[model samples]
Target: MQIDPRGPRFAAVLTSAVLAASLITDSGVLLAVQALVFALGAAGRSPYSLLFRAVVRPRLAPPAELEDARPPRFAQCVGLAFALFGLLGHLTGTAWLALAATGLALAAAFLNAAFDYCLGCEFYLLLHRARPRPGT
Candidate 1:
């Protein structure tokens, strides 16, 4: 089975570390960092694109045309929102909720890696197709 090249491996790493640390202590800082990572990716930071390019090309070998849809803008938004929800759960001391959200995100990434269907990305493309473009 082909895996998705753009799986959230890095984000998963960061989330894992943050979740570990969040367990032993109370630190808004860790949650903030997690949210920031998602925000950066959502904002189209170059590093995110570089990471995507690096992973997708040699590792997954998705068609070159996928670059035009790099990160799938709407998927990035969903990711950012999910991360933010996790952060909010942390701030509010909702441990189970926070963990559930984080776990869901991680599981989704793993599924994408294994099965090549990015659920969030599909939503992104749907949104992209439903909207009217500029000057159209």
Candidate 2:
């Protein structure tokens, strides 16, 4: 399925906010919440994305183009992976590791928010390129 290109960036803003708050507060629960959000996004049911579609998207002009969902979904999986690590590290008493992981997630979110640079999408593209094509 295709999606408005703005949708993922909008979601990234929300994700970055959550990540930044978790990093600043050192809140395991918050990180877990973000993990849940990431899981939802990976599943294509993200609350932020839903809200964007239902609320914000309706107010804006229609997008000029749409993009494939796979890249963004893959990106969400990457986010989920980081969040799981952060949560696990925090729960296991490895605060440094947790911070490191959360910080990494935060950096990625920030990139998406500030520049619309999707590392996850880039990674997805790289993987897609590396895989053998069906007819090749």
Candidate 3:
């Protein structure tokens, strides 16, 4: 599926805010909620994207380009993985691990939100390039 290029960036802004809040509050519950968001995003049913379509997109002009959904979905999976690790730390009472993982996720989200850089998307591209071609 194709998506407005801005959609993922919009989601990233929200994700960054949510992640920052979770870090400041040290709230496992909040992190869990973000994790759910990540899970939904990975499944291509992100609530944030729905919100963007229903609410935010209506206010904006048309996008100059669209993008493949696969990369962002892969990025969501990467986010989910980190979120799960953070939750695991919370469950196991490993404060450092929880903070570290959450912090890393926050950094990634912030990069996407503020700079339009997506590390996970880059990783996805890297992996896609490394895969063997049918003719190879």
Candidate 4:
């Protein structure tokens, strides 16, 4: 499926806010909520993206280009992994680990939101390129 490239960036903005709040308040529950969002996104049903479509997109002009959904879905999976790691740290009483993992997630979200640079998407592309092909 193709998606408006802006949708993921919008989601990233919201994600950055949520992750930052989770880190600042040290709220495991909040982080868990974000994890759920990541899970949903990975499954191709991102709430943030839905919100963007319903609420935000209507107000703006149409996107210049659409993107394949797979990369963003993979990016969501990566976010889910980091969020789970952070949640584990919270559960295990490892403050540094929790903060570090959450911080890393926030950094990536911020990058996407601010710079349109999705590290996870780039990684997905890299891995996609590296996979063996049938005729290689």
Q: Compared with the true structure, what per-residue lDDT tens digits does model 2 show for residues 1-136?
A: 9999999999999999999999999999999999999999999999999999999999999999999999999999999999999998998999998999999998998899899999999999999999998998
**Which segments of candidate 1 are over 4 A away from where they belong?**
1-31, 46-48, 51-64, 131-136
* Per-candidate clashes, comma-separated: 0, 0, 0, 0
C-alpha lDDT of all candidate models, in order: 0.58, 0.94, 0.97, 0.97
lDDT of 1 by residue, 1-136 (tens): 2223444544444445664565446555665665676667666652545665576546765544323345444555666677677777877889776776666655555545556556777776777789998998
Off by over 4 Å in 4: none
- Tens digits of per-residue lDDT for model 3, 16-72: 999999999999999999999999999999999999999999999999989999999
Query: What TM-score would you give candidate 4 relative to the actual structure?
Result: 0.98
Least accurate 10 contiguous residues by lDDT in model 2: 105-114
Q: Using Cα atoms with residue i matched to residue i, what is each candidate's TM-score against the true structure?
A: 0.61, 0.97, 0.98, 0.98
Of the candidates numbered 2 and 4, which has the greater lDDT value? 4
Worst 10 residues of 1 by lDDT: 1-10
Worst lDDT run of 10 residues, candidate 3, spans: 63-72
> What is candidate 4's lDDT per residue for 6-116, written digit by digit as tens?
999999999999999998899999999999999999999999999999999999999898999999999999999999999999999999989999999999999999999
| Model 3 ranges off by over 4 Å | none
Candidate 3: C-alpha lDDT: 0.97
Worst 10 residues of 4 by lDDT: 62-71
